[model samples]
Target chain A: MSASRHRLGRLIGNAVLLAAVATTLAPLLWMLVTSLRPKQDVFDGALPSALTFDNFSAVLHSVDIGRQLLNSVIFAGGVTLGQLAIGIPAAYAFSQSRGRWSRWAFAVLLLTMSVPFVVVYLPNYILLSEVGLLDSHAGMILPQVASAYGIFLLRQHFQAFPRAIVEAARIDGASEWMVLWRVVVPASRSAISALAIFVFISTWNEYVWPQLVAGAPGMQTLSVGVAAFASEEAGTQWGSIMAAATIACLPTVAAFLALRRQIFNVLLEGAVKG
Target chain B: MAPALLLFGAFVLWPIARTGWLSLHDWNLVSPDREFVGLDNYSELLGDPDFHRLLGRTLMYVAIGLVGGFLLPVGLAMLTLRHAGRATGVYQTLLFVPTVITTAVGALVWQFMYLPSGGPVNELLDTVGISPVNWLKDPSTALPAVGVVGAWQNLGFSYMIALAGLSAVSPTLLEAAELDGASGWQLLRHVVLPLLMPTLLFLATTAVLHALPNVFVAIEILTSGGPAGSSSNLLYDVYSNGLRFFRVGEASAEAVVLMALIGGAAVWQMRLIERGVTYER
Candidate 1:
């Protein structure tokens, strides 16, 4: 009787979690389904009676989504590479340095994570315009390259590296650059990659910053482009709007799925100060 | 190090100082000169009834976020510890999927989901004999509706953190509690919940700090802060005042106030992390 009761408990537990999962995924699934339905048949039901790729084609044809996608790639990729190039060295310096002042400096840097972009974007926007970088890819990518969260997370990972390995590398006459590139970096590949993926995903998803700086028609990232498309056309075009959203979402979603384990492992580290 | 500091200074630190300076003067975007306004902008902002409403609504958004993003995740995380079996990883991965989606796209997807006629949410409501609600258009529901979307996107991240906290609780202690004749609820309430407080507090703090900014994308995409500024918050107001309408001085003052608010939370957050580390040890 106890065994059967325990089984019933497990059965009920599974049911609850499954329901939660369904509720969580239902909206995304509906987005995909609605995007595929015939324009007139969007409200017909949850699942489309027939699949159609015309919405995707229509949105692509109507808007410069292809250019926007490329722009997103360049913008996100540039920001990611720039952050990693700068961040790895800075994180390396922080992890290697020893003293109270260094610790305080690191703390100060981490505190900047809480400084909301809305507060700073106005000045940054003006500064960029003053320098004539506004509405350009460099403008969008440049201001965001130095991320406190990235440096902090990378420092955490770098701190975990074995000190003995570093000592041996130094004794073998390895320069500081070699010590970082040849010794510590190769070992910290997973952390670096995880940070890269995060930076890329975030840069890709960024809305307000890009919207403010990259306002030009040819330079609009996928996020600003899709949002602009939706607000203008939402009154009459559910299918095409969903299609644009799907396009905007695909790259980040794919990156997250492919690197989920690294992401899940890094969550505890990020949450400590995130 | 030099390069990184230069970049950080140019972007983050310098802008903060510039904003503080800008807050003291009146300047439009196109103006060549800024007029010194002293505390006038602050006084004007403080005296405005609309600013008070925006502040209140911003707090409401934070409360909504605490419940939906922080509190609800705690419950869900506890539930996951039971009977999830081998599919635990799969469940977690699927749940976190929403967090990676672009905020703008996520808002657009939700705009469609909350569609008044024949949308999925209303269709679900219709099955229960309830009439379809105009979720976004109606002023009364727009704020909460948008708040719910922010919470939904954030729920996965918070849940993962809570689950990690739950897993860190020693099973031996749980067994000892059971041996001492403590009921399941007693063990949970007395032991598990206390241990989870640091994680929960962290989530709550982030939820509060992030509530206004995170909802910016949704508000811009879905309602543009709405049908009469009904859904507008302080952050949205700041954006409009600064960028859209070019009220530079007033907006900078608002930005200063916002930074102070978030800065206080960040200090609290740092203290919480320190305490949490010592507690864990």
Candidate 2:
């Protein structure tokens, strides 16, 4: 009797889970279908009987999606590259610093880890505008690159890094820079790429920051581009908005699928420790 | 060290201090005229009913999000943990793919889906022998609908956390419980749940923070905090006020208020979690 009961429970569990998976994916499936159908047929269920790329072409040609795509890459890629460049060095120095001042500074920096950037966005906007970076990609990337959490996370990972390895590299006649590049970097590539994936994905999805700073159509990220399309086209141009959203989501989705392991590692680490 | 210190001082620390200073002034962000107003913006905010409603709604969204957010992910975690087969990988990917979608895109997708007429959701409802509901149009239903999207977007992150918590749990404890004739329910209740407290606390705190600031993309895109501003949160207000209206002083004041609230909550979380976590071993 117990064995039968357990089997029933397992069966019920599987059915419920599969249903949830379908529910969660239904919207995306609908979006893809809607993006393909012509304007008249968008509301007609999950699959399009007829498929066309006219909506995609309209967004690209009339809506200026190509310009926005370039801006998004520049902004998100710039931030990703900049954060890695600065964050890795800062993290290394922070991990190796054996001094009182650095420790005090590190403690002070930790306070900002959970402080959401939204709080400082206004002032930062003002500063960026003052520096003539408003409506520019520099404005978009510069403010985001200095991440306290990045340093904090990397510091933890670096702490776990074996020190004997570094000492052995030093004994092998490698300079500090060479040791960092040839030895430490190769070892911590996973953590570094994980950080890159996060910064890039989040930046790609970033709406408010780019909205505030790069509101100009030529300079905004894909998110702002799609949002502009939605706000204007939501009522009458449903198919186009669907197409634009698909365009905005495609890259991040591709990245996530391609770099699945790295993204999962970062997200999993954040869930556990953060 | 110099680069990090310079960047942090220029951006994070200084922006905070400047925001504090800007809160005390009457600057319209463009004009050269800067008049000092002591505590006026904050005082105005305190008396403003709309600001109060914004705060209340933000708290409500977080509260409502927690209701489904905690239960759903925890349930998913347990369900996923029950089996260790290859199908688990496919299920995990399907559930997690939403997390990769841009929040703006996610919001747009849901906004489209929630259309009152000719929307797929309405069609599904009609087929299920229930009349269609205006998910985002009605004020009473709007916030919860928006909250559902947030919960969906975050479900994967939360599920991953719970799975980690489950796996980290000692297998010997489970075996011992089973050996003592403890059923599945009892094993989860007595053995697994207690060990999962830290994960819950972390989840709770993040759920609140995510609702406040991180949810703006959805709210901005979907409703624009509309249907009589039913879905506007504090951060959305900050964005709409300062950035949209160029009301620098008022927006900066709101930012400061939000920062203080977040700081206080973080301290509370540390205390709450540290007490339990310190003695766990």
Candidate 3:
């Protein structure tokens, strides 16, 4: 009886998991199907009867999707690079410093993470406008460069680094920068990869900041571009919108799939320790 | 250290301080000088019924999302944990795809799905002998519909976190439970959940925060905070007041309220998290 009950429990568990998987993946599958379907057949929903690339073509041609895609790529790339450039050194300093001030600074960084984007959006807009950087890539990327989460993650990884290695490198007369690059970075490949994936995905999918900062058509990122298509007053053109969305989602999805292990590791660590 | 501190001070801290200062004045986009308004914004916000409604809506959104988006995802993660095999990675990837999609895109896709006529959701309902329901058009259903989308988008992230927490559970403990003839439900309740409390707390807090900001997106896309501003949340109120109506002072006051609420919640969560986390030496 106990054995049978165990088998029953296992069966139920598998069934529930499969159901969860289906529920989670169904909308994405629908998105792909809708994107590939001909425009008129989107509402018809009989597997399109004849799948076509027309929606993707229309989305690309009718919209300034190419320019928008480029803008998004540049913005995302710039933010990722800027954050790494600034965050790495800061994280290193925080890790190496042995003072109450550093500890207090770290706490302040943690506190700042709770400040929502809305709180900063208005002031940043005004500041950027005053500096003639509004609606520019610099404006888009600069404010987001100093990420508390990135600094925190990198600091955690740096703390886990072998102090002996850094000591030996210093004994060899290596500079701090050289030790950071040659010793710490080389050892923390997983953490760096994880942070990169996280940052890329976030910057790619970010909406509100991009919407507010990059209002000009030429400066708009992919998220805002797709949002424009969706929010238009014309009749809902499901196929084209889905196609645009699919295109917008491609880069991040590709990145996530490519760095799946690293992403999972970072998420796992964050979940356990966050 | 100097370089890092200088950059942070110039960029992050200064901007935050500037926002606080800006909130105290009646400022505009093009204005050279700002009028001094000492707590006038706060008083005006306290008197506004719309702002109160939006705060209530935001609270409701957080509540619904915490249960559906946050807890449901944890449950799904636990379910996924039972199947630790080669295909688990595939499942994880597929499930997390929605999270990478932009909120605008997810809202649009779901809007199409929830269309009263010719949408798959309604068609499925018809097959089960139920009449179609207008999901987004109705005020009562709009917030919940958007909440569902939010849940769908966040399900993967929450699941991954919970799964990671579950992985840290010692197999020896499970084996011991089995030897003691503890049933599946008993093992889950008595052993697994207590051990997973820290992860759960973290997930819950972050989920609430995520949900609060997201109400604005949902309002913007689906309802624009309307059918008479029924779906308006604190963020949307801030946006509407500041951007739409050009009422910077009122918007600043609304924002102050939002900041206070979120800050309070964060503090409460930090305390809970500090108490809950158990370090294994």
Residue-wise C-alpha lDDT for candidate 2, range B1-281, written one tens digit per residue: 68888888998999999988989988888899999999999999999998889899988887866765566777776766664335766777788888888888898889888889987878888998878889887888888788888777877776666666665667557545544563867876877678767767766776666666656677877777878989777777877788778888898899888888888877776666556542211
Task: Tell me the deviation in Å of residue B151 in model 2.
Answer: 1.8
What digit string (tens of lDDT, one per residue) describes model 1 on residues A36-151?
98999999976678999999999988899779989999999999999999999999999999989879878879788988777788899999999999888899999899678888
List where candidate 1 sits over 4 angstroms from the true fold.
B171-186, B278-281
| Candidate that would win on DockQ | 1
TM-score of 1: 0.94
Candidate 3 segments exceeding 4 Å error: B31-33, B83-86, B171-193, B272-281
How many pairs in model 3 have backbone atoms within 3 A of each other, for residues 3 or more apart or on separate chains, i.e. clashes? 0
Q: If both were scored by TM-score, which would come out higher, candidate 1 or candidate 3?
A: 1
TM-score of chain B of 3: 0.84
- State the RMSD for candidate 3: 2.6
Models 1 onward score TM values of: 0.94, 0.92, 0.92
DockQ of all predictions against the true structure, Cα-based: 0.66, 0.61, 0.60
Query: What are the per-residue Cα lDDT tens digits for candidate 1 across B1-281?
Result: 77888899999989989999999999998889889999999999999998898898999898998887777877777667755768778778888888889888888889888989987889989999999999898989999999988887877887887777666666556445544553867876888668767777777887787788778888888888887788988888888889888999999999899888888899998888788532231
Docking class of 1: medium
In the predicted model 1, the residue pairs found to clash are none
Candidate 3 lDDT tens digits, A44-82: 754767788888898877789889989888888998888
Candidate 2 vs. true structure, TM-score: 0.92
